[model samples]
Target: MSRSTFVATIEPVSTCPVNCEACPVSRRDIEQPKARLMSLAVAGAVASRLRHEFGVGYAAFGNWGEPLVHPQIVELLAIFKQVGIGSLYLTSSLSARIDAAALVESALDYLDISISGVTAEVYNIGHRNGDWERVEGNMHALAKARRESASRLKIGLRWHRYRHNEQQFDAARELAEQLGFEFKPYFGHLGGIEAHEDFERGTLPQSKRRFIENSVFLEYVERAVAAHVGEGSCPQAENLIIHSDGRLLHCCALMDSHKTGIDFLALPRRVLESFKRAPNSHCGSCLAKGWSGFMHSSKVDHRSPAEVAAELAPSSAS
Candidate 1:
């Protein structure tokens, strides 16, 4: 089967500064503390493979860590563009200092700023240890820089909606509009890959489960899980995830331990396509339990829980 679209998510930096509650990178138990930055040479090689071999349409930098933390992030973005990758983007927590003017002038196509709340009290619930003041200031500076330079770089404010932060959605959206940014609000989920693994094994920690039950929109999660039940194929098969160390991941939902062992730079497209067709045990488990669908931001259902339940009733009966 030929895929029409392919995406590559490259991790520019391995370590994150902010300890977000929902992110596995923040948890030492899940993600061992290791600081690694992808060299420009390696990034260029990866970008070449993605463009020349896989014909990747979209490339995203930063999966586990904050891309802005990298001192030469602008150069990294430029590397992908230099390799002819069409759409290049990255998401940032905006907790660290960044050269907004340099970024605006870079080859980046889009920048998504991840924000949980507008205020410190609510923001700290998820973005623990993150400096709200710094994030706010960076947001404004980036907007100003884009306007001043007349850059076409699309800026989006991705607000993670939690139970406590619902009331702050309009305020955040208003701010995004005022800054000429695209406002996107979606329900937050359990942060770590370990959390999803534990949930599947029924061994999720009580504290984590409580966080999900309280903070997340349970109905939306249920619909998302049910909508993909019995799915034999994974949408992520068309996407490639590369670690900062160049390890190729099966998908974003799995841990580093589950990496394919082949360095992305050397892995042939035929080998990756074969691997995608026959996923390992970890990927099998995720697909079987519908967590694969749940993890994708674009797979959510807007229909009510009852409507989704009714649609899935026949499959449940079988």
Candidate 2:
């Protein structure tokens, strides 16, 4: 991401209680201490930096953590709004105990829900921490709240698919349609090829492997990828991510991993500039041919979730 505009993404926590089947990283995977709530003071510190230094007008509370888990999430949103950056976008698994009405009342422009499947078996297979009945109930309540409140908050459904639930796409899409939300299909890579070599080798057929690696699939999917990229207006140009340790980063995707790039908060702006100016070879590896392809990397980069909510100015209906 180039330029100096700030879009601070705060990751106050990590890992889901449910250990999904396709997930490469769960709360238990990290050897660090248990996920704890971020102190309001820490949130205030990052918010201060964002407003004063970066002129960041957008704040998103989801990245590595299940954002809804924050006890004062509503207060945090109110603080951002009080500071003139309330146009926040929330990304969550909807696993927290908060009410959907409260989330809708926060005046957040976008409420993106991570949903794996509709059926209990399929959904539970990928979302170990999820309860189909509970999520369904919450989502229905959310939709009702949106209608009654007449809020412009747009709800989005993101589905992470793998071999286990590949057959549930139709049902997933139907659920999204039923909810009047857009559905995004994400294919997850189990990190390094060697890490999940046995799993991948066993699950992905030769034909599927060919489709993913083939140049034709890449070309076919690039069109849709371009459209999605265009909609977000390239996050790389306007995004910034703030880690719980008080470090700011160019992209949330790069967070927790030093191999992606330097931490902007820890380094000089010049260093960030130099890093962004350097080529991102990994982007080339992201061909966007299949679901997993998009999850990998891609040439079409965009702003961070923070920047997207701020600069992109999500639609009132979003």
Candidate 3:
């Protein structure tokens, strides 16, 4: 988020192929203009700028959607390598092809597979319409690949925590360890999890709630140290968050069209300069809370190709 050290977060697609019922994007009413898939040129250019110019060390290929779903995902990784990106991280649901053989041989630094429960029925509560059988099969494939390839990929089975699935942590961890993968648990926002107890009761305090309801500024600092994400003066960020379509995002959590700010494709240089000058207002706490007294925003496709081309084309506006 700062000018000194920046990281790149890209969502290759707004819509995921898997229909996880609890996923916010699965809400049929939600709509945001998303790229059909990340174009090779855009991926290459962004990676180059961050690595060659800004000296970024890593590029995470996922944010909201599954990164592996990209048709050219491996190719995209090649772009990062080509541009001197130091490392790569990928997060996926493992609902589709989990070609472990290919993955173990790739240049990825980390691979996180999100799973909520161990059993098919239990996993379905969070994953919704998921196949536990398929997950197990793919994980075995991954383990086999790791054994054969001697890969150093930091593979982990990320468990999204919920009231029901919390009990399965031990078995899940054991399974992960057996398969040469670490088992991690995290509270997903979609499970309606929050950072505080105030969310559950109807009487959420008005004062502590001002950050989202009335957030003043996104706190960003380089080399400055502090405590939490809500802490402003602390040097917290390592990357410049952006959508593949070119909106310079405030953070990975808030991707809704309204929340995303600046069209980077049209004014790449200008947007970079603007973010350095001004703190992001749409991030940190939140600004999209509604009748439920909770944060919510639903838009992702923010590319403006026509405008981007106009800027690059030989025109007087340039």
Candidate 4:
């Protein structure tokens, strides 16, 4: 049987200009210059592995780091195309440095941009200002790039929805249509200062709180699980993140200290081992009844004993 995994290259930068209300990384506030970009050598080595060792005919170049910030990103992508191996996916904040003509030449299979809202003010509440214009400009450029590329380069929007910008739904949908990209709204599990503060002050109001509680949220979770399971070919298995430092994590949603890092280049067995051993804390929580951790219950493997019992119990017969 042929097995496949979505190879996500996690490039981490030290700094981001945004101050969004749902920022996940604790280090977002550090008064420091941007972190170092991953060296071309490291990227090239990973590319080589994707082609040869992993037999990964499908790969992506973005995850943690802003692909736009890595000056060598385009170059690395070019090399991947040259190798004539697999599809390439690029996830970006749609910052300004994106070049339509150049990226179009990269022969990407899919391109996804993260857009939270249609207006700067709405986006600014969570992210920094320097990005607003650039993100907008990049979106336009990507639209053009998608049109020009010979290969079917899918352009799509990954919207991280928040209460402050919930009203942007219609406008964002319109923008997606105008930009020639598919729109996908995602409620982020993480929040920034403003969102946290609002929740703390009991300001989230009854309606919004109820929205979070209603079956709609469950439906979203189901969709997310179905999508992942479809892609992975395993409902119990999951997507994970292996950082540049070789840290194995249970995806960004359940990111925490319970991680394992090793030189995946030198130790492929270790990589597989970590996958078996390092199930996310959220996974454990999923086994506990009434647990409502970040890993949405609907996304959990419902075949588990707890889930089976809950579904088959007499009380649930009604």
Candidate 5:
């Protein structure tokens, strides 16, 4: 059966300057000895392959790293557009200096900005070492650029809700709405699937443990685990993640790219699908433990923090 719509997520840049606490990039779990940027030639080739071979209609830039860090980010977007990829989007922390006017002119469909809080103090709790002032300024610049150019580039503010940031949700949402951007708030989790596994095994680093205990919404984690343990296949199997080095990752959840032996430039779609379907140790463990479900949950628990705290109190006491 032909796939209706395949999505390709390519990482134009493979290093992030922002040190978000819940990101593997910040924690140094996914080691990058040196930063890498996908060359225009490689990106164009990958885009072409995704369009012609996989029938990928949608392309998203950014995975473990920030795409804005790349000097040729606009050119990278254009390459995908040139390949006839109908929909293209990218996610960014907006911590780096952004050329908002150039991005507006890039024929990009959407931009999802990852934010933890509106205020610097709370925002720093999750997005450590990130400058809230700079991110805010970038947001404004992008908004102004879109307006001035009359571009159809949709912007979204994805708020990573933590215990300390819930009160700021309304303020952030207001700001996004004021700028004609979509505001999304969801409970944040530990860094990666590896971190999630560590959390379950009570092996997380002391700092990460403290952050999870004090910041994350435990009720959401519990409910997600209850709702989806060994109940479904991995949703990530359908999507493709290409590293900046042109290697195909098993999934975005994977931390060690070296372990993924698949080469994006050479692997056939049928072989890739067969490999995706075959159970591997990492995916097997994540699936069996319900971490896959938790990560991919579509329904957000909108209960107040206090309510969730109350619900989880008994479990914590035990």
Candidate 6:
């Protein structure tokens, strides 16, 4: 008999190394709870089952927390690789300590390093309590690992823009390129600054509406941002973000109480079907309050995950 496990966008640890002005978890200034890391045994069992059923490269590793903070991360990855899981994908704040040797040797196929500002003061404004030098050092270390291993790992950096840090944009992009990594810039969510439920109303609040209108971030990633949110937003009613535990949230951005997700493993197929079929209350703001777009959840985006993976995978053409 097989001991069962379930696949999810795993969060091995529920801790963020750096506090940001826009992150909901970090906004609790008074008596915030400590971070929670998932049980390695639980993660291993799920990964094994997914590997048995779907083969390698079928799961994503990071969602909300810093996966690098898990003390046994190397071993955790080794289990998946042992079972033949392919192309582990993860994104991080690059604020956590990195084990370069372990990371390069593991199953991590893709890593997206997040940066908010280019200059020290400005970068700290968003990254709060972060050290620019340390982040830069980690970036170099990751690049070094890729070079030394002659590995197939792909690394990229994303800069989430804000009004205060707009001046540092070009410099950061240039630095990322010089470091031999892809540089992407996008506008960030403003809802985290207020009550998490505020955005759930599906319509913009006057303050947030005004902020979006004047934000420097809007000028940089207008089209991309629009595609993901606001008018003509991409429909993601089927997409959900899963926590280290089995808890799920409707949209990646919404973490409030209204749209409580069904435990993925408790009724895996049913939950997944529900996840794939309809829009929930939590996604209203992300769809720009358009009920019509919400109704389009079952519509196909015309690309499957496998197709996306193949596109990103190195060309096998000879």
lDDT on C-alpha atoms for all candidate structures: 0.76, 0.58, 0.58, 0.53, 0.80, 0.58
Alpha carbon lDDT at 204, candidate 3? 37
Compared with the true structure, the alpha-carbon lDDT of candidate 3 equals: 0.58
Write out the backbone clash pairs for model 3: 6-239, 7-238, 7-239, 7-240, 33-301, 34-301, 256-299, 257-299
> Please, what are the lDDT tens digits per residue for candidate 4 over residues 16-109?
4443334433333322223466566666666676566655566555544566666666776766666555677877776647677777666677
lDDT of 4: 0.53
Stretches of candidate 2 exceeding 4 Å from the true structure:
1-4, 22-24, 27-30, 191-238, 249-251, 258-318
Best by TM-score: 5
Kindly indicate the candidate among 1 and 4 with the higher lDDT: 1
Clashes of each: 1, 11, 8, 12, 0, 3
Which residue pairs collide, candidate 1?
22-191
Question: For residues 217-274, what per-residue lDDT tens digits would candidate 6 score against the true structure?
Answer: 3322333334444554433433434555655555544444214655645556555556
Q: List the candidate numbers ranked by TM-score, top first.
A: 5, 1, 3, 6, 4, 2
> Per-residue lDDT tens digits of candidate 5, residues 79-185?
89988899999999998898999998886899999998888998898888899899989999998998999788989888787777878877887898999998777
Candidate 2 lDDT tens digits, 176-218 = 8888887776543342322233333565433333323421123
TM-score of each: 0.88, 0.66, 0.71, 0.67, 0.92, 0.70
- Model 1 whole-model lDDT (C-alpha atoms): 0.76
| Runs of candidate 5 exceeding 4 Å displacement | 1-5, 299-318
Candidate 3 structure quality by residue, lDDT tens digits, 1-318: 444466677777656655564454544444444646777888877777777666788777776677776777777777887788878888888776666677777878898888878899788665665677887788888888888877788897876654455457677778888988876654333312122223334333343233222211111110111222333431213446657665666545443532545665556665675564454553334322321122221211112324323433222212
Per-residue error for 252 in candidate 2, Å, reads 3.0
Off by over 4 Å in 1: 1-4, 31-33, 200-202, 257-260, 297-318
Cα error, candidate 6, residue 163 (Å)? 3.3
Which 10 residues in a row give candidate 3 its minimum summed lDDT? 216-225
lDDT of 1 by residue, 1-318 (tens): 465477888888867878787777765556453578888888878888888878887998878788888888988888898888889889999988988899888999999999988999889878878999999999999989988997889998888876667678778888999999998776677764577777667776565666666677666667777777666887767778877777677666655543354577776778877765677676766667777777774632334334444643322112
